[model samples]
Target: MPFISQIERQSDYSRFSSSTPIVIDNGGSYFRIGWAGEDDPRVVFRNIVQRPRHKTTGETVTVVGDHNPALLRYFDCTRSGPRSAFDGNVVYQFEIMEYILDFGFDRLGADQSQIDHPVLINECPCNPNQSRCRMAELLFESYGVSSIAYGVDAAFSYKYNQKKGICASNGLAICSGFMSSHAIPFVNGEPVFEACCRTNVGGYHVTDYLKQLLSLKYPHHSTKLTWEKVEDLKMENCYIAPDYASEVKIFQKGDKEAEEKTRCWQLPWTPAPVEEQPSEEEIARKAERKERQGQRLREMAEAKRTSRINELENEIRGLDFLVKQLEHVPENDVPAFLRDTGYASKQEIESNLAKATQSLRKAKGEQVENEEKGDTSNAEKYNLLHVPDEMLTSEQLRDKKRQLFLKSTAEARQRAKQRKLEQELEREKQMKLEEAKRLENPELYLDLLRAKYQELSEKVEQRKRQKTNGNNTNGKQNGSGGVGRGERLNAAQRERMRLLASAAFDRGKGEDTFGRDDEDWQLYKLMSRDNNDDEDDNEADLARVSARLREIDPTFVPKSETGSPAEPPGFRPLTKEDFQILMGVERFRCPEVLFHPNLIGIEQAGLGEMAGISLRRLPSNDEALEERITKSIFLTGGSCQYPGMIERLETEIRMLRPCGSAINIVRAYDPILDAWRGASQYASDMQLFQQQTFSRDDYFEKGEDWLRGYKFRYTLT
Candidate 1:
């Protein structure tokens, strides 16, 4: 399991005297605090703070370090996430630092008005003078401490390991922490800060890179790959490869060893419910319901027809009575009588009576014999037309001309009806011939029909592709960029563009004669955006072919009407494979960044390279000292706990040193806690604290120049 916060308050604070100094290993990743001379810190937690709102009380409260995520249900954490005080291993934000300090001291059982013990804390190597001054001011002014001492965490770890006989006095310490990695060469049991080198790539970069790559590869589970979770994953699975390229090849070929190394994290999922088929009785009940609804509709339609027939019969009787009454009235009184009945004249009344009689017969389900009546009335209807116009009066001549017009119109309509009947006969004959041919060879006929359908479909699709400029690779049309100024255009559009370009550039070359010829005016029509003749013709031809195939072939299924390729269904039942996160190459690829900082775009020397750089920067010119330093190289930090880290570092350092040089690498007893333990042991010496620490009065009296040049001695007895 990963490290959990030890925030249970210690109850023995009152037992210690006021002179006992407080040792704090203020690291970029964790904050450890304990009393001097102790074997372990009294309080340890992640160096982070969160200001979440209480769900019940609706007030913001500070939550420091990792808490029981289950208990967080009582708070609303949307506004503020966990925040750190360090910016790339430097404490620039003091406000957050203050919160972390408050939690650390409170957990250590400090109940006094202000912390009164002398404090010993660790800071990064070569820390800026401004940052150190601000830190001193905070401790002296806020905590009211009598004196404070600052030291490097890596130096403390090195001294602690040295006391344990892990390495000689002259050696190198490779400290790879959370935010950055450093290689500090120690001479005679003292850390040499002037010869140290740092690379801004460490455990934090590895975890972040893994999180990003996994989130992009499986975007649907991005929310599940939290920073804390990814950090845990990196610690559990990541390792330094002996040969990056060769090790990656094992995974690329999917070898058995790679499979054995792979880890799978299964997410939550549930199977979809199976659908049940309906019973025979249920299907019968639905059919009966539909039949009853149809019967009700038929009865209502019959009643409506009966009511309409009765109304029409009454209208016909009234019109016939008015026509009979028109014969008795004088011609002068007929106009007034017809006006009261809403008819213009006797002829109009007769026409209305005939139309009503025909409608009443049809509504009663009896066909009207209009064709027979027209055939019988033909002789009387054209009687005036056959009379000689010159031998009759002027009124007779006008009546004969009207009768001739009616006769010609009637004949033309009959001819049209006869032509329509002949065309229908021809279509029936053609269908019979095709049906006979199919009956003789059904297989051949179906093959021919399918081929015809496919050809027409392809032709139509090709036209659509040309119009769209064929950029629809994802099955979605190029809605915006297909026909823009610099994009591809169709044949007609290209020609039009060429014409416009010529017209524009031709004006400056010579005298313009744009509209001198009649044909030149036609250029505007060609450039019109409404030109769609080819599209319309293609659509009509496709429709005709599709209809013909559907009539001839029983197994024909036309493609979708939208012309675009059919898209897959949006929803699918998820399976175990969908939820499983596999770790193949990712296991070692993330940690590989430490040995090759350039892999993650960082241009600094890696941890291994930094060791060689540190050795070269030593002020000593003796080759014997360099050889001795390489013999006692020590790896001590939180990141040094990886499985193959020692081996990988030894190999890398050997490559950088001279041939046949002796190389040695050892790990600290407890990489994560040794820094705090070492500081606790060192701070136990009261006389050493007086020698290395500075009082607040000295800080002001000695001036800023004195503080800038201040150095701590780590070899104190």
Candidate 2:
């Protein structure tokens, strides 16, 4: 079950007597506080602290435990993550721990300046003297507690189950807490700390392992696998395997039982809307509208052409009349007649008449191939008679130079056209040869062309991928492009980043003198993310092969835009199964870390090995004592609640013990809360409480040396 906090304030704080002791289960995962002799704690919360800045005040405020997320939006908590008071199961940071206690006591309706009653808090087994002294100092000075008593939570759980007659007085307690696991042997109903075996694998490690595994498998959905969500998944599905190797073989072979055991957690997803094709009536109406628009454009073009033909005819008539009038005048009067017009001489008028005649013919939809076809036809077209400049006037020399430049330009255009026609002839000749070979052996021709087309297509595809991202050379590419860029970068991309950094820092030269040089602009082109200078020469060759294959092989399909194979249209609607995270072998594989700590890279005893290690470390090797301890193996704490934990622990312990050793493994009724209940029950007796507990003056008088040897008596509880 998921853990829920109870931080509501209680109303009856003054109802208890001054001598009444308070119990607090200072667990690594949570903090449970209440008055002694009660069945359950009055207030419980996550033992976490957050110091966030207020949005309006810009001052930091201490927030303990979980609060409404909407209310937290008013604070800027990005500067730090949630801080824990405990490192492993031992409290080291008392400054943060004081805030936790303040919240716990405040929530329990403590409005007074000081707590008049004594307090009982649980700590880790064999906790360091420095940590113990710090806890005592914090309680005595900060909270003003009358007295304090320390105990191990696992020991409390063991004695609580012992009081219920669930196990014998002589036994072993395997308590798996949040950050660590311990196997403590109980002799005469009291825990032997010297024989305890502790491993740094617990519920926290199992949940963390599961989170990492899921994140790596479905990396795109890693953001959804929050610690809280994965913890819930672990509680619901994780379990201990009877034999990890044998259980894994079932899943590896994909047996029917494995499929039955698998569970799935579906995530939230919404299907996108599908587009519908146009109806036949709509298509017909669109085509009709397009035809009417085309008709109007055709009428407008005809009217423009007719108007241009009329203007050209009128201009030609006017020029003809000028020529006739000039012919009637004398040669000397020609200069006088031409002065009225814009022409400099009679040859200039003839030049204008010839150009008008050519333009008029061209407007009548006639070709001008003969006009620009041959260079021999226009040898004298720029006729300055190849004259020397000394024999001509200054104006004549300028005209001759202009004519030479025009002649050269026109010849160059003619040469380019001739070359293009020659290439076209060569291509037609190749096509005829190919047709002959296809007719001779159609099947062979089809096979040869198909092979060539496939090879060229692969080459073109490879070149395209390399140009887009050189890192995609390996097989990390999915349809979603390639591997993400954060973890990796191609050589070109790295260079670009280096250039950008260099430009920003000015190479440590100081002063803002960028963009002064012309070459500096070229640096931006190299640094640009979209700039790809690589050429694709194979694309043209692939197009040629694809076109040839299409001519001979009717079944041939191309991947180009115009010849692409059609896929059935429309998207498949998303289903619940598409978003589900499947738990097959992972359901047991992750929890198997409890029995094999090496799975998570920790070289230590696992949960099952801890029991064997604890038994071996006993001072005496008495068979009867070992048998009694094995007979009443009590399993407690949150991690011990997995489904097959009892059976698996019994099997692992049996292998270490002699033949037919009595191994009774039983779980606590409520592993999480039983320790608190046990502490409360123990603190009820005033006589025993007064003997073990110490006041603030006693703590200061007797320092760390005395606190090191102080131990709680669990047998009396």
Candidate 3:
């Protein structure tokens, strides 16, 4: 593994001459910079930029690379994350690229107004001219570099390995980097771009697949699986499976080998909030506090009652005094005397006194009359009802009519009360009978009750589904489907539709007597959306059955509006194991995406398949040339370092080739830094390096057409 550490600024920048070429591998994942032909890059950081606000200053500052854990406390980076300047290894956003370059150059200890040295950067294969032009413009205008050169990272790694005798001049380079993977066929030491194929599946996709799996398996621990942590896990544990199905079967069968291979990352687990028993003192104090609150509430209620009783007594006394005073006054002077008490006459004063006396009795906790003593009061209350209209005066006749109305209203109310009391008695009798049956045979009664509940619930659910056009609990259509133009409707809605159809079909066919008949006016009510009048009856029956079942059976749970159990159907108690996430199949399963990209929903060719595709695309139909490419197959890039990668690729390519074909899959000396090392070796020769690069004057004079046609010759290196 490459040594990953925080990049420190170099102090020996001035030791290198101005003519020294700076090597930069502007990869999608990381950035590296140093003098050309060096043993290693002097500075390295994640190739990402961030503009986060300082928490104390509230100023947005440009920060490059991964956020340091120590520095995160000083910045509000919630709204921003490490952002890449490349779009799949090709520079697209110049502003972000500028930030990355600034950080890379600063870390390399560039302390000049202009870099002065030539820059050699790596880009993806078949990069567009727009990307090159933008990069060239930025380097020339922003950094003021002496010259700029571009090379593919894969090509550099391939050439570097080829010179080391790891691969032949005519071979294939299978580089699985961060954002994407590539298989480039080489002919006479030059990478064959026409025969190369790229799969948009690499380390990033593998890490993402693993992250998704972890999220699904342990949703509560999402924040624990950061990208960097998952990347580390991938590096530490993930490996390509020799055969996906057979490998998966090992885990599926729960073999000991699978358990041995499974990796466990024990996250920081905190104990759950267990219910602990309280000490005697704690319990006693709690009970005392509760009792004090209850006593205070009771005292408050008692005080309020006493205050009300006193007020009622005072009102009664005042009314009694008014009544006594009115009794002494003359009849003509009675109205004037009562006027001061807001009463018009002696009868009004007596009515007020009677109300106050009744209230005072009630507030004093005395039994008050029910006021519904119709059997006793009816005779005196409607005395005038017995008198004939002609025998009585006009005022008496009016009173008789009012008394008659009141008598009928009172009788109706009494009948309703009697019916309600009889219904209650009947319900009580039925409940007692049901209770006796339950006691006689509890299981049988419960089964019968559950059956009834189930039947009613289904009936109610069907009716509800029809009314809602098959919408589920979420108000969205369920698997059965939604309410389209031909949606099934309830009986009332169907009838309304039938009536509407008839009305529409009758247009110009007969006389329009729609509103002539009184029955025709009822059409609009039936056409209304709320036409299901008997739905409530079915729901009420279902509710009754559900309630009965709940009363008898502890396991019975009521269905919700959508007919699903309000709570989980079976009360399967969750254990700590449910919270734990065990990774068995995922170790090899995630890395298998490089061989089967379809697992991640990407329809691109896999890494091994890309090799086959690249070989088939070669113009040379000679079997010897193809054999040479297969025999010296070289694997480069960070993702190619997986434990079983070479074995898997060998197995995959062996199946595609003819029997006994020479298939040697070799890993790069350093899959990651070899690209930079290759570029360094290529840039060591000043004459050859200068030939491959373009100065600022050359760029403006030749125009973009020349830049589009640019390709560095690795053979010269």
Q: Over 4 Å off in model 3, which ranges?
A: 1-7, 52-60, 68-83, 125-151, 159-170, 186-195, 208-230, 248-269, 290-327, 344-413, 423-566, 569-590, 598-604, 616-625, 682-717
Judged by whole-model lDDT over C-alpha atoms, candidate 1 comes out at 0.83
Error of 1 at 515 (Å): 23
lDDT values of the candidates? 0.83, 0.83, 0.83
Off by over 4 Å in 1: 1-8, 52-59, 67-81, 255-257, 278-570, 700-705
Show pairs that collide, candidate 2.
Answer: none
RMSD for all candidates, in order, please: 9.5, 12.1, 8.5
Worst 10 residues of 2 by lDDT: 529-538
Quote each prediction's TM-score.
0.72, 0.75, 0.71
Would you list the clashing residue pairs of candidate 1? none
- Compose the digit string of candidate 3's lDDT tens values, residues 88-153: 767788888887787788878895458989999998888888998888888887888999999999
Clashing residue pairs for model 3: none
Q: TM-score-based ranking, best first?
A: 2, 1, 3
Put down candidate 1 lDDT per residue, 106-133, tens digits, no spaces.
7888953488898999999999988888
